[model samples]
Target: MRLDKFLKVSRLIKRRTLAKEVADQGRITINGTVAKASSILKEGDELAIQFGTKVVTVKVESLKETAKKEEANNLYSVVKEERVTAE
Candidate 1:
């Protein structure tokens, strides 16, 4: 699945367009490298997303074209989440 679509389908970003924008702006990383909106997502890949000062890291658990809200969390596992502190 595409990174942007995976983010939206997994309910992480809430919208596909927002996810695409974020990816395009280099706020999204796959396996520690910046990823574009069309980046391919695969199971077990690590994804790090920057949202303002907060960073969220997760591992892709599954990929699906469509999933119900209740099953969204099954798509990825949160590995780390931290807010950057201004120094």
Candidate 2:
């Protein structure tokens, strides 16, 4: 699945366009490298997303074209989530 679609389908970013914009701005990384909206998402891949001062990391668990709200969280597992500490 495309990274943007996966993000939306998994309920990570809430919208595909937002996800694409985030990806285009280099706010999304896959396996520690910057990734684009069209990047392929696969099981076990690590995704790190920067949302303002907060960082969210998740591992892809499954990919689906569509998922119900109740099943959205099952698509990925949160590995790490932290706010950037002020120096």
Give the CA lDDT, 0 to 100, for residue 29 in model 1: 94
- Candidate 2: segments with Cα more than 4 A from true spot: 85-87
Per-residue lDDT of model 1, residues 1-87, tens digit only: 999999999999999999999999998899989999999998999999999999999999999999999999999999999998766
Clashing pairs in 1: none
**Pairs that collide, model 2:** none
State residue 47's C-alpha deviation in candidate 2, in Å.
0.2
lDDT of 2 by residue, 4-83 (tens): 99999999999999999999999999999999999998899999999999999999999999999999999999999999
Model 1 misses residue 25 by how many Å? 0.9
Instruction: Report backbone clashes per prediction.
Output: 0, 0
Q: Residue 27 in candidate 2 has what lDDT?
A: 90
TM-score for each candidate, following the candidate numbering? 0.96, 0.95
